[model samples]
Target: MNLSTSNQPQDSSIHILHDKESSHQELGSPSEDTDQQYHHDWKYALKHYFPHYTYQPIGTVQIEERPSWFYCVAYGIQHVLAMFSGVIVLPLILGYDSNTSLFFSGVSTLIFFIVTGGRVPSYLGCSGSFVSIILTISNYTSTSNSEMNTNTAAVQGAILVLSLAYAVVALVVIVFGCKWLEFFMPPIVTGSIITSIGLHLSFLSYDEATKSSFDTYMAIATASAIMLISVYAPTNALRRIALLLGTMTGYFIHAMCNLKGVGPSIDYSEIASNPWIRAPSVYFNLKFDSSSIGMVMPILIVLLAENLGHMKAIGSITHRPMLRYVGRAYLGDAMGCFVASLTGAVPFTTYAENIGVLSVTQVFSPLVILFAAVFAMLLGFFAKFSAIVKSIPQGVLGGVTIILYTLIAITGIRIWVVNKVDFNDTRNIFVGGLPVILATVMQTPLQVNNFQLDGIGAATFGSIILYQVLQGYDGLAMYRKSIKSAFNKNKPRETV
Candidate 1:
């Protein structure tokens, strides 16, 4: 009995009794360390900011060596199909040429994607959200500044200056504010703002899915199918491509149905007659007045907020930290918007349509999305190509857009939840409900100050103004001040 008591094991502090170094070798691999660092620096922030979700990196093309054109093309089509419906509409609504913007926007998107190192898998196109932003400012300046002779060029010039300024400030979100993004965008204000964005934008896709530029029901039916399938399907590559593939399929179905000829009319005549390669005009002239900056700055803030939400969403979807990737996206998005505004395309944003694409496909390669951007550019210059794509019946495109837009709305809700927003609070309730409801109302053809604030009517009240008023009276002002302190203790306090 005494001899048996000596056989007990003891905890090892340093030296192991057996050949345990092999176990350390197995567990302490360099790849594992790199992965852990990646997760901590980026992925951890993603979990802190976005919805609870997962992606398995579907459809990524290998970049260890140059990828083949076939791989690029296949990936590009999927990207294009995912993004096109929402992208092309920016031109259609704002009375610009869709083909022209698409061709160039496409090109700009690709270049930026490549420049950003293909870390995000999404395409760029004309952003419809800016239709209201541009037309609002243009119409405002046109009517009020009539004595000053401000043209669309002047309107665009003002926007360009605003975007450049925004880009500089946005960088501060990283240089200073990303970790405490909630300070300025406290869950309540951000959640409300996002909800307002979603509620306001809901009808955009619905309008596309439900009606045609020319009246037709079949087209809408086709579009709706695309939207619904993309939204409801299980997350996988096939689901990611759902709306895209469905839209193409709908186009085919429409073509077959129209064998005898009946759908909204499309005229390719202008495209056919267009020049092969004309350089777009740059640095349009300005006729800025004091009031115009006041009008534009609010919309710019809303847009920047929308874009910030998107980066957060993508980070959640990819399980990657936006801290590492979002600055580039903001840079690209602002640059893209500026480029678009210069060319008479409405400003653009990162679309929620790609959320479906990610859920369905599971692949997240920035390169694949960029390829689509390059293809979009080529399409932009080719009038015939633009005309052909634009010719898809409004109803069919609408059908696709309705679901995509709704999903976008849902995405906003998802973001709100991830941020742990307390919806029960009255501040959340007031700012949340009113603007969105009013925005939906004002998004129609409305006029104030001879200014067409259009989609932004919700953010207003009295001479105080739209959601812009929130910064002055709502919790956002307090949060922003706190953020400034957190960012710079020495920063002089400024009232909203």
Candidate 2:
């Protein structure tokens, strides 16, 4: 069920499936028949937003099956918990409204499900892919609240443009097919870009952790806890929430330090003053700065690679033909970003953490994701919840994020490993290794008078250009070899 193999033609390395015609051939029930038979009216119309799944054995749930209401809620909570730690980090780091981010994440998830016909089960949360570029655009030298807010507004405007660009890319995929993408951004290039991004962000995390000695220790404890629980925890449930649990452990330790008068105190005033339920502070003001747009545009590549990788992974696990709907999935993801952009939130991407939950639970039901979205929205409305999220110590977040960032880098390396990218090939060595070096060293923004590009952007465009250049060189070399051989064969009796 590897989407790459399932959809590809025998002769070509990449060939996209005709989603409209071929997608439903392998489906269990006719899409129209199932829709008409089960959902006759308005009440079940809501259910139509969900995908159709047939019954599996008692323990396992497939994409189209409906679980009990209780189980749905239970699994829904599991998904939210798995995604929460990662989702909140982006807004918190960027000084955006956390409540707004939480609310729209749910909204975006609903939009994604509808646009994809509920086939691809995913959660749209604030993306870290934009972090470096946004930071480069914002260029924050002062940490004042007013300045941060100003920079955040400027970043949001750039994000609006980025979102529109993403939607355009999706539209192209829908119309022209995704074959060009495969050739343009082969696994090596995509994987290298991903790795570079991870390395770039890891430095940020490390810097944040080292702000204070106590912070550094807290970070170590948090990362260690996450690694240990994820690797050695006996139960799947514990392993799934390792990030959350590890952060909590670090938070508790920091609180104890405060009691001992050794570390910075946790600010609880916001939590105490906030009402239990309140509307999120959401606003829209898009500013289109050319420099900012240019800085952030490269993130589009990462988003594309991430979405494709996520769908392929899900397809492999579920043993389903997931890529047939990939165009729709991309559209849905773009819509999610479009919605978030209007709300002054960062763009969203498919999360691998939630995919891990699916792999372990073996539940592919989109209904569960729907419930999780509702839960996230409810949490968004609870002002106290946002306050609590905001109150998490910087050190604790530092520790947690360092691990998360490293994981991001590892994901890119995993892509190389899983796809078996050959480093022995000089072309791959240049395409993959060079971008990573640029990403690692160019941690700060590179400035050339009026032009500015961050490490992530540099790595992204650099890899693509290098890949094309190397490909051309290889092609030319092959052509020269053929010419040389033909000339030798056609020479007139030279040896006689």
Candidate 3:
């Protein structure tokens, strides 16, 4: 059954009719007994709400069936580790509690599943797309290990407003369709936005790594470990955990250095002080400022593009017609971001890292992802776990961030490469180049009036306008045709 279709069976009794043959049997009769009909309807609702585990015996692991409990748990943890490096870094960089971020990540994933009818195999995580905007609006300049941005509440309020904008975009995509969005944000524009996000944070990575000479060495060592493991691991499973393993190895080295009194020692005080079980503190109460809204709302475009691209990629991979679910995917993501923003957590989005894990492990079951979400929520409730995560050295994180951030930029370039973007045309070149340049320059923290417009904000909105204006001129298409004709001019004529 193509669940993506609007014509999916709506009859309550359809749940019991497992296959087409069975469905035919039930279609001809309506139960005259009210109690019997009500009972069947209740069962139907339960089946749709929470499906049972059924083995397919002969197909790729997919949404419809659940794997064994043991396999589910194992793959679930793998998914968590795949996304851990990306998810934890956001809160650490932005100075929010990592535990709360984990909690919301899990909650958001489940929400995504519910909205998409448990069809999409995506895991929601902290989005790098929002980093530059948050930093700009909060006016955060401190790179130290201490407390960050005193005005985080204001940033939270801006995020809350931004969530509404996401919903509006989702609604538009649902009602009018994604074609309208594609008119403005093509591969060139979207790719540039992705590239700009990584470039904008390059400075932060360097700053974190170079805090001290010893730290710089540790950072290099940590990055080396990740590289070796990711590239040379004997098994796919080990490769999946490369980031975690590398970080742990770096921690061991740091511990030894501390024992020799040559490097900063691990501070166990936070772990010792924190209770085993405690709720995440409520820090992001909304305080809507109009200026903050302008600074942050532009990010909605970037997030929309990111989510849409991911959905398309997953669709292509699973060979499922996912276009119909695009609207629900956007709405689900927007809802997750809205919930996360309320609690001072970073906004959520479909994670490409987890998708990579799915690709590698060949495990596409949604049930495994659900297990991972539960594990993430459990981590959030444990204060000790949060403290332990906090104990990870900044130099170590910087090493991983250096790799991850660089990959993000490279991923953007790959988008163009994969799409066969015609850079021969000057229009494509200008569309791609200008946004990246503007975004990179704006990384220095530019502002107008009370609004702090970061590189990402400029690049995203700027690309949209540039593409539209260039499209109006229609010069690029003509130039591209001319280039093609010139190349063919020297070729020998073929006999017809």
* Candidate 3 local lDDT, residue 43: 61
Query: How many Å off is the CA of 19 in candidate 3?
Result: 15
> lDDT scores for all predictions?
0.54, 0.75, 0.75
Candidate 1 lDDT (Cα, 0 to 1)? 0.54
lDDT of 2 by residue, 159-272 (tens): 777777888888766555555566667789889988998898888787778888988888888888889999999999889999888988888998998999987888888889
Q: Which ten residues in a row have the lowest lDDT in candidate 2?
A: 9-18
Query: At residue 181, what lDDT does model 2 achieve?
Result: 66
Shift of residue 191 alpha carbon in model 2, Å = 0.8
Candidate 1 segments exceeding 4 Å error: 1-73, 110-122, 135-151, 179-181, 201-216, 228-238, 241-294, 397-401, 444-452, 455-457, 460-485, 488-496
Q: Kindly indicate the candidate among 1 and 3 with the higher TM-score.
A: 3
Model 3 residue 8 CA deviation (Å) reads 15
Question: Which pairs in model 2 have colliding backbones?
Answer: 52-64, 53-64, 53-65, 157-287, 219-399
Question: Given candidate 1, what's the lDDT at residue 255?
Answer: 67
lDDT of model 2, residue 213 = 93
lDDT digits (tens) for residues 362-421 of candidate 3? 777788889999988887888887777778777877887787788778878877987889
